[model samples]
Target chain A: MAGEVESIEKFLDEYMPSAELKEVKRLLYGKEIRLLEFPAEAEELAKEKDFELKGYGCDAARESSRLPKIVRIAGVQNKIVLPTSAPVAEQRDAIWAKISEIIRCAAICGVNILCLQEAWTMPFAFCTREKKPWAEFAESAERGPTTKFLQQLAQQYNMVIVSPILERDEDHGDILANTAVIISNTGDVMGKTCKNHIPRVGDFNESTYYMEGNTGHRVFQTQFGKIAVNICYGRHHPQNWMMYGVNGAEIVFNPSATVGALSEPLWPIEARNAAIANSYFVCGINRVGTETFPNEFTSGDGKPAHKDFGHFYGSSYVAAPDGSRTPGLSRTRDGIIIAEVDLNLCRQVKDHWGFRMTQRLDLYAEELADVNKPSWKPNIIN
Target chain B: MAGEVESIEKFLDEYMPSAELKEVKRLLYGKEIRLLEFPAEAEELAKEKDFELKGYGCDAARESSRLPKIVRIAGVQNKIVLPTSAPVAEQRDAIWAKISEIIRCAAICGVNILCLQEAWTMPFAFCTREKKPWAEFAESAERGPTTKFLQQLAQQYNMVIVSPILERDEDHGDILANTAVIISNTGDVMGKTCKNHIPRVGDFNESTYYMEGNTGHRVFQTQFGKIAVNICYGRHHPQNWMMYGVNGAEIVFNPSATVGALSEPLWPIEARNAAIANSYFVCGINRVGTETFPNEFTSGDGKPAHKDFGHFYGSSYVAAPDGSRTPGLSRTRDGIIIAEVDLNLCRQVKDHWGFRMTQRLDLYAEELADVNKPSWKPNIIN
Candidate 1:
């Protein structure tokens, strides 16, 4: 028996090259072997085959790790209008019908989550100084028709809905808040996150109409995953996205109603930046089409028909965790953008890149905290 | 005079529609104001021009805020390769001449910073790991001929030079480090940021030849602005770029010697991510052309020529802070890419987007520092 074994070994050694030894080892050991061997004459023949096998193994492994999970999201770019000459009742009915149409279509598309542009049930009223009548549209979050409609739709379609609206706290009386409601598929109110930053410039005379949000940053837990919303103009601020990411949001939405000229360039920059920095997918929805509203006020210089209301140019898009964007559904057409997002991609990217892991956050906190101080101004002028 | 003004306004109001009044305002303030009040209509226009402007007096009394000075910068992608297989002494001479030629040409084209491909002075030696005698081509960082030659060229042309090389740290007993050095225009050793991450898979076997970098994140201060280097495989890590940005780097260079098939895809992804996330300009330099060495190492598994060397497909490019890349400098041509980048663009972006000001550093720190056990394991059996 020993002679027979020796003869077999001699025959293998004579024919096999040292290079093929590792492959032969793998055949004997099943899948456990790290190295292998083969016959000298077989070396040339095995090269192409070995690479092909390795490529196949890698592809299979990547595919298995990347199991696809489909997610549907919907957004409404509130094109609600309030004609200066029209009564509040007439305006409200017109806007509500438009919003209802949006919600119905979103439900039909099988969206699990639907978000509306900032204050979806009303026109952007912060563009002028006229206050009292405009403020009348604001109501209690739970009592508002926008929330009631969205909540009913969530139950009807078994989907989570995000309703952004102007909230008038009856208890607080004077202060209005820009609030968003996170409703469950079962129509239960999950939570709410308010817009933290309010712009005080240009057409955004938000300070005249509403106070800055005081809810602090918050994320909602849902059946799909942890999610958060940064409403409209809040997308301009990176902290809004960062707050959600730190709180464990895997998906964040930036629901906005902005014009093409004023905010188009910012679209590509902000969404991708938020995605790459936080390692989370971002769904950005902008209102499509134009809304015409009658001018109610003149400029301080007594100029008639001072500023025609701006157009809400919609070009909504979704950015993946890898900072790549899917071709948008449309800016003009009200539609949903469906994508297969693997939550695992976030983990894989963060593990490999370690943006969050290696960041020296301590230094940034101390330095950036004082950057806006009056004393921090540099002498150099632009 | 007041009665005349009131009478004219009343007459206009009685005769013109509100839309016509809107057109009058545009005529007064629009770009075509001259056409609205033509000289033929009134030589009285010349008399009105002499009247003192309302805001002009205040503007004259108040000194204008000094504008920030703008400096134009040009980033050059130098696709370079040293003849490594040639006799060592002859190879060193050829490289020195090549370095001088490149610097002179780049300076003539008005490039502010010329970044060469990673380890341009030596061929990549990690293909098979046999440790041939020629592998000693990797030199000490402080005394390397490549570093010395570039330093001389920097002083000669008064240009900032970024040189990446296979560094053997003499102070650390010749410990190898993949390093990139940023030399000031005056030839001062500004600083060096060693590549922190070493890729272990695919065509990248860098860890086999060099250990991970020990230098804490660093940025070099120069006449142009703050600059940093992400050497070769380090570009794969977004945190590496973030570190540079947090340290106040305005321009970052990704010097890479990557091949066509494996790395070309990563090329578009990595640089754009770095630029968008950090809001800083990125210059990506890649080596061009196919390089074949004298010997091939068979796989330990007795497979024929297990490692077929890679072709360095050079698609060098410069990405603006907004993530827009200039048409890539040709991979085929060994030439300089020059673009006048306004340094003021960084400040303009920061002011507009407010990314740094709005970042929530405290929250990110806590999340990243939490080293909880992972929830999943590597899928090895796929």
Candidate 2:
């Protein structure tokens, strides 16, 4: 029996090999989100940049009344360009250069939108939990140098960019937030949504830095489609995904960072479940490579302190509303996954599945209210 | 990439083969749900009974404060015996006999709880859309012939049996429900929870015979542990699974009947996602084999009427609280899956993950209220 399985082969095997996947493109995902021909120069660009690049298509049966609104979205996963030994600005800038190559590739493939891994500009340093130079990485989301750089790339590429970062909220007492900033193709900082749930598990305790997001589920309506960002830990919460779908997001991106083995089993499950339940396109991007921090940190589990988080495992991919998905990128490498999806398929799936129509939200809302009472009791029958 | 994949190899590849899987038992899932030695005679019994029998174990570290509450749960997936051509009594009797062998096997294996596939005693004739003969399968939850038979078996085996069936409510104008009847090990009729979400997709639409359940998530307190049932279509609804978790269920059973390809991609994802999100053990049992109906029906998708609902694709398995799971049963065979779980792992995982602690129920309750309002707008940034 497959109990607590360890083989890397099993994780990669969840997705089909390229050749066989095409034959079953019509298996599900409402009207069959077909696999399109690979983008020209995809492998060449991947080989040149030393990063894995893969793409899939989510299509709809064109109706006479509704033109298929095809929107291409790209997700990138990469390690910190230079170690924490480098100056913060220089380190962030190195990532800027590394990510720029992927952004240009996304542009070459005509991506309408692109998303980066959580806190992409800096080393995932929350494991150290020290307050000095690490806090310096937090910046104002609106004016952050990372967001500004992405705005230029967005304008240069004529594409929307979602940049997840550690936001030092300037107006609100300068408290920090784990946030995703949305930059429009027109080079405007459209809006930002904070990461609602922060990790307290293992050494990934961001509560040492930021609290739960103050902002509710926020969906951004861009020229291409309606989208939302459920940062990192928020993917574990079904309601977080539910609210974004409730708000009519056609596509939801899970910009996440977690070590391998710790979460590899969960990686392929959650975002796909969200996509299936919410009837939306979902992109899951994770940070690649393990980084050795300048200082050692303890997980408080009686284990010796360590300097490095495990590999981030960069098997990012896209899932369509009909539950069909693209194969993940290499788990051991920096990579870019681009999926072109039709926004109309979201509504078509909702129409066919009738989940949104029959979701019984009122029943849950009433029960949740009852659960909140001080005298609340579980619905357990003895 | 893996877009709309069709090959059988891909799905089976998601699980590691036995020899390799045992190596990394502690990868995640808290303390790691280990694969224990197979029940004595498991292989021989499987061969003799002509069914697949597999088992895994979930263990926790020995603590000074509490003794381990080792509970063995079993899930069975099988087709209706003797066909609909036999009288309802004969059909039900044949099932009772076939299941008796498994019940005896569960007793030998010392299974604390056993759950059968959805509508196990019938031909899954909802696709026929006919009222006569099929409706005869609906029996009272408390006095249903199937439940009564299982009650006797439960007492005989000192086991709790979860029987999912077409329920004919005697007090409610003979209204039908897709329900799970919980019978205690001592032969008492404990309680029943109806299937909340009736699917409208494809030929699995139970709305043709029954409406959505009125009984909210009800967790039954058995001698072994607290358990609940999330019926077939309810697995598609995250809230349905969430409510069961909220009701303090230690183990949640999903007794489902779905055809291959229709939901093969989603089968391994949902229940496991629930177990991870809710910090509970989950058992997912799916009906095996295809059942051809007495008549043809159209899905209204412009295809000609069909007589069968494709393949049920039995791949029942158990998922532990920390996201590890047993390999699913053979997709083509009748089988039973047994997992020995220490319920304490649920709390240990919740402590380690803190998902339930940070779930923020009030926020969702408040937002869900707004969602119900006619003038409510999604928090969309244009």
Candidate 3:
């Protein structure tokens, strides 16, 4: 029996090559399986450019362009306990120190445009539905310490920084908004676009904190490329991605903080869809690790009280215009994923696919005009 | 040295289980890995219900609902040579016969809703750019021979059929449009939706044959469920999928005939995105095999002359609202993929995800209203 089993095992090994078996495991386990890694090239380029690259490939085809406008984009996913027991000021400082370290790492990696996870200044504590203390976390989008910290790094590295923050609009009677502040490479603040969509699922309770964004889809033309931030919940809205595309965004960054049980399956689908549907590049960033609050919270489902908001399985990835993607970052660790993207691919893909030329916007506008009307009805039988 | 290598190999094998190694290979190769298959359950149900079920697992969860609205949907991907040398009438007969054989197999599968590939009645000869002979493929949407043939099968099997056809609008000077004729289980005509987005890339030259569809995003109310058809190129449009969701479609069928090189990568992404974005089921179907035309066609890319329009690589699959999907059908051969879907999951997901309730359509409408005006800009710097 032992001999027979050994022979069967040998036959299996012969039938399925070890290399093929390893790839299958990567798919089944949904682990970080790198398709292309050019550590030697990155190391060489970093030394020449005086900027370190923690080692990632540059997917630029030489023959595809006469003058390629290539840019390295980095999305950082970090997780840390806010130390709610500490003073609010100390808590803020600790969070900033942690994120700045990550940003410093991104700078060493030679990222031209760096994006931090959504609302990086504070913990995702809105699930508690406690207002007074959480409201204290919101600050001025421009004058906030978070902005000041990112601005210093942006200017030092001469790189663009997209910092998603919970903004306290002081001029507008202290109304709060989820906003992404775009800082130019010159360390000057560009414009900011507030998150258009606010999630109301389970423990989100985002509507309690801020109303829908007043800012429409805004694209910022930075030194590296034309970019926009589709902050967190806005990723679910296809029209949000479309408007950015219509506005000529070459790359859109979706910085998010979602849990594993809530949206892990969808994390891989939407950004890639945006990249393909809009004929552009997408850098999807998510926060990592599990944060347990002081009090237990219910997910609104028929489940027992849970201490944490499920796992924030960070799988930050970059989706290219050609429907190719970088291997996602580790699900339970802090990391930055760097991808060298040629902005020209946006135009090439659009021309090759003709998605923009063929998209029927006029037809959609007419249909949308009826959405707010009382006489409007979807083709529903029930 | 050989003994040392063998010891190292044994250690590596022990470290990485053979089962995991096998899964990794499947991912790397992107093989047809079945995520769901339940032939025995389907066979048993078919015996009791007077219909046969081609063994495929259904995504419906029994405990999730008191009365689960579980419906088995089938998407048929077919490939048949048109025999252009023969009389066009004989060519039509041969194609219909081949498709009917596939449809009969679908009936055995106890599929509640069955969808055929896009423009399945004739060869995809639009590449030749010869309108004189290809226009002959167009027939009346309501009184078309394809609709008549499908009506017979739909009634006999008590299944709803979505048949995409090249329609000749007899009411308007015999104008042509890409349309999907919806046949009810009782053999009644359940209205039709036209293909809104038309591809004009390379040899597609679809604009030469038919104009863009004007039917709007119309969801057909069938006996089985509320469904809509996003014919071929229309799948590329996110708003096209959104409007259907706005109008309340539970399932959207994207019947496509695209070559492998042109869109094989996107084939898996878009429909799955639609399912996740809209919180609905997407049954994406595509035609298979390569058909060599009498004349060689250039794809306008300055490439060598090619007699075939690349391989279709049929990989029809169904994506559920929970972001899970069935393994796609064979890429090289014609086949049918069946999936059992619990329609109630759509509402469950919407409630959990809150994508619909949270989507700020009003904000988008305000932005889209500026699309035609000169004052509009998408935050572009250059």
lDDT of 3 at A193: 89
Q: Which numbered prediction scores highest in DockQ against the true structure? A: 2
| Clashes per candidate (backbone, < 3 Å) | 22, 3, 18
Q: Give the residue spans of candidate 2 off by over 4 A.
A: A1-45, B1-45
**Per-residue lDDT of A1-382 in model 1, one digit per residue for the tens?**
1211111123333444453433322221112211122234334322322210000000111446467444555555544555544776677778776666555555544567767667766666677667756777786787666677777878998888887878887778657888888888888888677777776534566767776676655778777666788877777655556667766677788877666435553465566567766878777777655554455554233456554445565555556565455534344444444443556667665765455664444444444444434564321111
* Global lDDT of each candidate: 0.58, 0.84, 0.76
**By TM-score, highest first, what's the ranking?**
2, 3, 1
TM-score of each: 0.69, 0.93, 0.87
For candidate 3, write residues A25-106 as lDDT tens digits: 2222222323334446544543443332333443544553378887888988877646655656677788787666666666
Cα RMSD, model 3 = 7.1
DockQ (CA atoms), all models: 0.04, 0.49, 0.37
Give the CA lDDT, 0 to 100, for residue A314 in model 3.
79
Give the TM-score between model 1's chain B and the true chain B.
0.75
Q: For model 3 chain A, give the 10-residue run with minimal summed lDDT.
A: A1-10
- List candidate 3 segments past 4 Å from native: A1-66, A81-84, A380-382, B1-66, B81-84
